[model samples]
Target: MASDQPARRATIHDVAKLAQASTAAVSRVLRDAYGVSDDMAARVKAAMKELDYRPHASARGMRGKTYTIGIVHPDLRNTFFPDIFSAVAEVILPTSRQIMMATSEWTSTEDVFAAMHDRRIEGMIVVAPHISENKLVEAARQAPLVLTHRHSYSTAYDTIVSDDDAGAELVVRHLAELGHKYIVHLGPANGRLATQLSFVTAKRARAYRNAMESLGLGKFAEVAGCPHYTFEDGYRAAHEVLTRSRRPTAIFAGTDNVAFGVIQAAYDLGIELPRQLSLVGYDNTGTGGLGPLSLTSVDQNPHEIGTLAAKMLLSRMDGRESVERASITPQLVVRRTTAEPFE
Candidate 1:
């Protein structure tokens, strides 16, 4: 007959006993605390691995350090975000800290922040936060905060962003030089509000208009708004604009994901790219560089942005007081998607 008793889970004490070390020594190894020796750390880690022992995050938090950093982003489908995330991981690899990621795809940004707060994350890096500045400032009071893709003058947190204005100008000027007098910009509609004008999409749209005006193409400049940055929104918006009587010879999409939709929509409509329509997208994602797509886009140096954001957050965690801001310049990578308009 088999015994009905439950198996006991491995604990730190088990780890210490297995490693022939005291509980205090095991604790020091787990915390990555100072004064831990190389040989002792190797023995303790091996013992823990053999025992399959995992530290309780809540218990670790009770001791005043979770050794976890939280990263928040709007969408996980965007490939550009992974570049930033990988860079951040590289910077934190040498430290004891680990990263925890949260996405606002199905919940509000506020809810995500609250969840991170509950977990007692040591620091936070919010990418393209949709929340107001006041709310952000309120959250910063609880933990070290760093923001990417947002331009705020608040001294409460550090900011890392790419120059959206310059990037937008680059796309518009490129299309204009390709003999595209009728050019349209497709971007998110959510940023139309007065308060949300600081958003990257809104800034890009404004810069596109300004660049077109400067090039004497103001009369032909148009902006088609997408409800979201998803591929479906891009496809729908493209259909509407491409079907118009005065169809734009060129379209500048707010993101590569959106540009992908435009490509599909143009294909469905029997329109040839670079002949009937020239398209450019922001965020030079890897998928966009595929042979079939070969999309023209602007590179915002997401890796550099992520690296800086992680460093800034770590600095704040280390008790840096003054606010800091860092910006990266954007570069346009022309591919096979764009060319001079065909007569």
Candidate 2:
């Protein structure tokens, strides 16, 4: 039901002419670059809307003005990335580029690459499970690349990651501070590539052990269920914890959604949070601050993570460096979910 008359893709001159301005000014409005007045920008946008002027994809390819960046997330079903993605877009506004997204959902990287390649994205930001070093290098060979939540395995791209080891330690230390004698860690399921990392799930496990030993409560440190980063996974794990004879006094989930589900499970069992048992989770994904949940968690700052990753990718595309890496420290956010161990 659409016209095939070349689709009449609007050009910068069209918008400029309609707005009674120069093409450079219109370009500035489109790029959100330096020195465009608010009135000018509004007029340009209005003209663009009136003309139904979509920037031509092929023309953009000609000028390398695709003005688009692809972000590969874990899954959109989880609310985590929406917030982060919005933040990244906000930061990119000044740079005049738009954001696009893809998700692996723990799916195959080959599938991710095929989709990205077919789309002809100018550059990409991949946040995948533990991917092979060679596979990531190959993907970078195709386009400019930046990785989120994973470390750089090769010099082909940049990496933006959080201090997950310290994050794990924070959870255990919080439980120790609350006088918890026994603590159980609910981590990612073993199937994903992330779980196989020397520095991710493995690092968290090691950090938990170190923290427990430091508190002289190593015997109480137990690795419980491996949930697949979901509320339902957390819910099921909570049931297992509740059934334990010497149940952990506190539970630490690797992510916030998982913690939310654990809280729900505890409520259903008539267990009092922070009373009969304390709860803690990672990734302060807004949900932790809800009045009912108020989950104590580690702030992985996903928005900051996204913003930083985009900057890294852009820098690489600009030929700033061959390989660069950055790390963010995760902070503990204390709320109502954790309390002193009850007698």
lDDT of 1 at 167: 97
Clashes of 2: 2
Cα lDDT tens digits, model 1, 71-133, are 999998988899999999998754657789999888999999999999889989999888888
Off by over 4 Å in 2: 1-11, 22-52, 188-195
Position 341, candidate 1: lDDT = 96
Worst window of 10 by summed lDDT in candidate 1 = 189-198
lDDT of 1 at 234: 95
Scored by TM-score, the top model is 1
Question: lDDT of each prediction vs. the true structure?
Answer: 0.89, 0.78
* Root-mean-square deviation per candidate: 2.7, 3.5
lDDT (Cα, tens digit) per residue for candidate 2, span 16-84: 899999988887777666678889888888998898876767776687667787888777767676776
Q: Model 2 lDDT vs. the true structure?
A: 0.78
